[model samples]
Target: MSDSGLPDGFADLDPFVADWALPTRAQRYEARLSKPYDDLVSFYDAVAPRAEEAIAYLNGLDINDLPDDAEKLLQLLYSMILVSYAVNVFKQNRIPDSGAAFFDMVAEPAV
Candidate 1:
Protein backbone atom coordinates (compact mmCIF):
# COMPACT_ATOMS: atom_id res chain seq x y z
CA MET A 1 0.00 0.00 0.00
CA SER A 2 1.15 3.57 -0.61
CA ASP A 3 1.81 6.14 2.09
CA SER A 4 -1.68 7.44 1.58
CA GLY A 5 -2.97 4.01 2.66
CA LEU A 6 -4.89 3.47 -0.56
CA PRO A 7 -4.42 0.14 -2.31
CA ASP A 8 -1.81 -0.15 -5.03
CA GLY A 9 -4.11 0.28 -8.01
CA PHE A 10 -5.63 3.40 -6.46
CA ALA A 11 -2.43 5.30 -5.70
CA ASP A 12 -3.35 7.85 -8.28
CA LEU A 13 -6.11 8.90 -5.93
CA ASP A 14 -3.79 9.43 -3.01
CA PRO A 15 -3.48 13.12 -3.65
CA PHE A 16 -7.19 13.48 -3.00
CA VAL A 17 -7.43 11.23 0.01
CA ALA A 18 -6.70 13.81 2.66
CA ASP A 19 -9.32 16.20 1.41
CA TRP A 20 -11.88 13.94 -0.23
CA ALA A 21 -11.81 10.63 1.64
CA LEU A 22 -14.08 11.87 4.34
CA PRO A 23 -15.33 9.24 6.80
CA THR A 24 -18.90 10.40 7.33
CA ARG A 25 -21.82 11.88 5.47
CA ALA A 26 -21.67 15.11 7.41
CA GLN A 27 -18.02 15.57 6.72
CA ARG A 28 -18.47 14.87 3.06
CA TYR A 29 -21.37 17.27 2.89
CA GLU A 30 -19.41 20.02 4.57
CA ALA A 31 -16.55 19.39 2.19
CA ARG A 32 -18.86 19.60 -0.78
CA LEU A 33 -20.19 22.92 0.39
CA SER A 34 -16.76 24.26 1.28
CA LYS A 35 -15.00 23.61 -2.00
CA PRO A 36 -15.39 25.57 -5.21
CA TYR A 37 -17.27 24.16 -8.20
CA ASP A 38 -14.07 23.69 -10.11
CA ASP A 39 -12.62 21.65 -7.28
CA LEU A 40 -15.64 19.42 -7.30
CA VAL A 41 -15.34 19.04 -11.05
CA SER A 42 -11.70 18.11 -10.74
CA PHE A 43 -12.49 15.44 -8.23
CA TYR A 44 -15.41 14.13 -10.23
CA ASP A 45 -13.44 13.96 -13.42
CA ALA A 46 -10.58 12.08 -11.79
CA VAL A 47 -12.61 9.55 -9.85
CA ALA A 48 -15.68 8.99 -11.99
CA PRO A 49 -13.80 7.07 -14.63
CA ARG A 50 -12.42 4.63 -12.05
CA ALA A 51 -15.63 4.28 -10.07
CA GLU A 52 -16.73 1.04 -11.64
CA GLU A 53 -13.35 -0.53 -11.14
CA ALA A 54 -13.28 0.59 -7.53
CA ILE A 55 -16.73 -0.84 -6.92
CA ALA A 56 -15.80 -4.15 -8.43
CA TYR A 57 -12.64 -4.28 -6.38
CA LEU A 58 -14.49 -3.51 -3.21
CA ASN A 59 -17.38 -5.89 -3.88
CA GLY A 60 -15.29 -8.91 -3.00
CA LEU A 61 -14.51 -7.56 0.45
CA ASP A 62 -16.65 -7.67 3.56
CA ILE A 63 -18.32 -4.28 3.70
CA ASN A 64 -18.48 -4.18 7.47
CA ASP A 65 -14.80 -4.93 7.86
CA LEU A 66 -12.90 -3.33 5.07
CA PRO A 67 -9.16 -2.94 5.51
CA ASP A 68 -7.71 0.45 6.35
CA ASP A 69 -6.81 1.33 2.78
CA ALA A 70 -10.02 -0.10 1.46
CA GLU A 71 -11.97 1.90 3.98
CA LYS A 72 -10.30 5.08 2.76
CA LEU A 73 -11.16 4.15 -0.80
CA LEU A 74 -14.75 3.61 0.25
CA GLN A 75 -14.83 7.03 1.85
CA LEU A 76 -13.42 8.55 -1.31
CA LEU A 77 -16.21 6.90 -3.26
CA TYR A 78 -18.75 8.33 -0.84
CA SER A 79 -17.35 11.79 -1.41
CA MET A 80 -17.66 11.21 -5.12
CA ILE A 81 -21.37 10.63 -4.66
CA LEU A 82 -21.69 14.00 -3.00
CA VAL A 83 -19.62 15.63 -5.73
CA SER A 84 -21.79 14.12 -8.46
CA TYR A 85 -24.73 16.25 -7.44
CA ALA A 86 -22.68 19.43 -7.75
CA VAL A 87 -21.07 18.44 -11.03
CA ASN A 88 -24.12 17.00 -12.74
CA VAL A 89 -27.13 18.87 -11.41
CA PHE A 90 -26.63 21.87 -9.22
CA LYS A 91 -23.46 23.07 -10.96
CA GLN A 92 -22.48 24.64 -7.68
CA ASN A 93 -21.19 23.70 -4.28
CA ARG A 94 -24.41 24.12 -2.31
CA ILE A 95 -27.96 23.46 -3.36
CA PRO A 96 -29.44 26.24 -5.43
CA ASP A 97 -31.74 28.65 -3.57
CA SER A 98 -31.53 26.45 -0.53
CA GLY A 99 -29.73 28.86 1.69
CA ALA A 100 -28.74 27.78 5.20
CA ALA A 101 -30.74 24.58 4.73
CA PHE A 102 -29.41 21.35 6.13
CA PHE A 103 -30.56 18.20 7.82
CA ASP A 104 -29.00 15.91 10.36
CA MET A 105 -28.94 12.26 9.43
CA VAL A 106 -30.33 10.47 12.44
CA ALA A 107 -29.28 7.17 11.07
CA GLU A 108 -26.83 5.95 8.50
CA PRO A 109 -25.63 2.51 7.51
CA ALA A 110 -22.23 1.56 8.86
CA VAL A 111 -19.36 1.73 6.40
Candidate 2:
Protein backbone atom coordinates (compact mmCIF):
# COMPACT_ATOMS: atom_id res chain seq x y z
CA MET A 1 0.00 0.00 0.00
CA SER A 2 0.95 3.60 -0.46
CA ASP A 3 0.60 6.37 2.09
CA SER A 4 -3.07 5.63 1.70
CA GLY A 5 -4.51 2.46 3.18
CA LEU A 6 -5.30 1.01 -0.22
CA PRO A 7 -4.03 -2.49 -0.78
CA ASP A 8 -1.10 -2.93 -3.15
CA GLY A 9 -3.31 -4.21 -5.96
CA PHE A 10 -5.68 -1.29 -5.62
CA ALA A 11 -2.84 1.14 -5.97
CA ASP A 12 -1.46 -0.61 -9.00
CA LEU A 13 -4.56 -1.11 -11.11
CA ASP A 14 -6.03 1.41 -13.51
CA PRO A 15 -9.28 2.72 -12.11
CA PHE A 16 -9.94 3.95 -15.62
CA VAL A 17 -10.08 1.45 -18.43
CA ALA A 18 -10.61 -1.21 -15.77
CA ASP A 19 -12.34 -3.72 -18.03
CA TRP A 20 -12.85 -1.33 -20.91
CA ALA A 21 -10.25 -3.10 -22.96
CA LEU A 22 -12.68 -5.37 -24.85
CA PRO A 23 -14.67 -2.65 -26.55
CA THR A 24 -11.68 -0.43 -26.89
CA ARG A 25 -10.04 -3.40 -28.50
CA ALA A 26 -13.06 -3.89 -30.75
CA GLN A 27 -13.38 -0.19 -31.45
CA ARG A 28 -9.98 -0.48 -32.98
CA TYR A 29 -10.56 -3.87 -34.51
CA GLU A 30 -8.41 -4.45 -37.57
CA ALA A 31 -6.35 -1.34 -37.03
CA ARG A 32 -2.77 -1.25 -35.91
CA LEU A 33 -3.09 0.96 -32.93
CA SER A 34 -1.87 2.58 -29.79
CA LYS A 35 -4.04 2.54 -26.62
CA PRO A 36 -6.78 5.10 -26.05
CA TYR A 37 -7.29 7.42 -23.06
CA ASP A 38 -9.51 10.24 -24.32
CA ASP A 39 -12.42 9.37 -22.09
CA LEU A 40 -10.78 7.58 -19.19
CA VAL A 41 -14.07 6.74 -17.55
CA SER A 42 -15.54 5.54 -20.81
CA PHE A 43 -12.81 3.01 -21.31
CA TYR A 44 -12.95 2.01 -17.64
CA ASP A 45 -16.66 1.29 -17.82
CA ALA A 46 -16.17 -0.63 -21.00
CA VAL A 47 -13.63 -2.88 -19.38
CA ALA A 48 -15.04 -2.93 -15.83
CA PRO A 49 -16.58 -6.37 -16.18
CA ARG A 50 -13.24 -7.99 -16.90
CA ALA A 51 -11.79 -6.44 -13.76
CA GLU A 52 -14.71 -7.61 -11.67
CA GLU A 53 -14.28 -11.11 -12.94
CA ALA A 54 -10.59 -10.97 -12.23
CA ILE A 55 -11.27 -9.87 -8.69
CA ALA A 56 -13.89 -12.52 -8.13
CA TYR A 57 -11.47 -15.06 -9.48
CA LEU A 58 -8.72 -13.79 -7.24
CA ASN A 59 -10.74 -13.29 -4.12
CA GLY A 60 -9.68 -15.46 -1.18
CA LEU A 61 -6.60 -16.58 -3.01
CA ASP A 62 -3.79 -17.71 -0.78
CA ILE A 63 -0.16 -17.54 -1.71
CA ASN A 64 0.09 -21.29 -1.39
CA ASP A 65 -2.93 -21.69 -3.62
CA LEU A 66 -1.31 -19.70 -6.38
CA PRO A 67 0.25 -21.59 -9.23
CA ASP A 68 3.79 -20.98 -10.40
CA ASP A 69 2.32 -18.45 -12.81
CA ALA A 70 0.70 -16.40 -10.06
CA GLU A 71 3.67 -14.15 -9.49
CA LYS A 72 3.90 -13.41 -13.17
CA LEU A 73 0.21 -12.63 -13.29
CA LEU A 74 0.60 -10.14 -10.48
CA GLN A 75 3.46 -8.38 -12.23
CA LEU A 76 1.61 -8.33 -15.52
CA LEU A 77 -1.55 -6.93 -13.95
CA TYR A 78 0.37 -4.18 -12.20
CA SER A 79 2.21 -3.25 -15.36
CA MET A 80 -0.98 -3.14 -17.37
CA ILE A 81 -2.67 -0.88 -14.86
CA LEU A 82 0.25 1.52 -14.96
CA VAL A 83 0.19 1.44 -18.74
CA SER A 84 -3.53 2.13 -18.75
CA TYR A 85 -3.05 5.12 -16.48
CA ALA A 86 -0.24 6.45 -18.62
CA VAL A 87 -2.23 5.92 -21.80
CA ASN A 88 -5.10 7.84 -20.28
CA VAL A 89 -2.99 10.75 -19.12
CA PHE A 90 -0.74 11.10 -22.15
CA LYS A 91 -3.02 9.85 -24.89
CA GLN A 92 -6.56 10.08 -23.60
CA ASN A 93 -5.93 13.36 -21.69
CA ARG A 94 -7.94 12.56 -18.56
CA ILE A 95 -9.75 9.75 -16.83
CA PRO A 96 -12.95 8.97 -18.72
CA ASP A 97 -16.32 9.65 -17.12
CA SER A 98 -16.68 6.01 -16.26
CA GLY A 99 -13.66 6.03 -13.97
CA ALA A 100 -16.02 5.73 -11.03
CA ALA A 101 -17.48 2.52 -12.37
CA PHE A 102 -14.01 1.24 -12.96
CA PHE A 103 -13.25 1.81 -9.29
CA ASP A 104 -16.45 0.14 -8.24
CA MET A 105 -15.16 -3.01 -9.88
CA VAL A 106 -12.21 -4.70 -8.20
CA ALA A 107 -10.24 -6.53 -10.87
CA GLU A 108 -8.83 -5.89 -14.36
CA PRO A 109 -7.02 -7.69 -17.12
CA ALA A 110 -3.44 -7.16 -18.13
CA VAL A 111 -3.03 -5.01 -21.24
Query: Compared with the true structure, what per-residue lDDT tens digits does model 2 show for residues 6-33?
Result: 2445434434322322323323221112
TM-score of each: 0.95, 0.33
lDDT of 1 by residue, 4-108 (tens): 999889988998999999878988988998888899999999999999999999998999889999999989999999899999999899889987877889776
Give each model's whole-structure lDDT.
0.90, 0.41
Model 2's C-alpha root-mean-square deviation from the true structure amounts to 13.3
lDDT for position 40 in model 1 = 92
In candidate 2, stretches whose alpha carbon ends up further than 4 angstroms from where it belongs are 1-49, 92-111
Cα error, candidate 1, residue 108 (Å): 2.3
Q: After TM-score superposition, what is the CA distance of residue 62 in candidate 2 from its true location, in Å?
A: 0.6
Q: Pick by lDDT: which candidate is best?
A: 1
lDDT of 2: 0.41
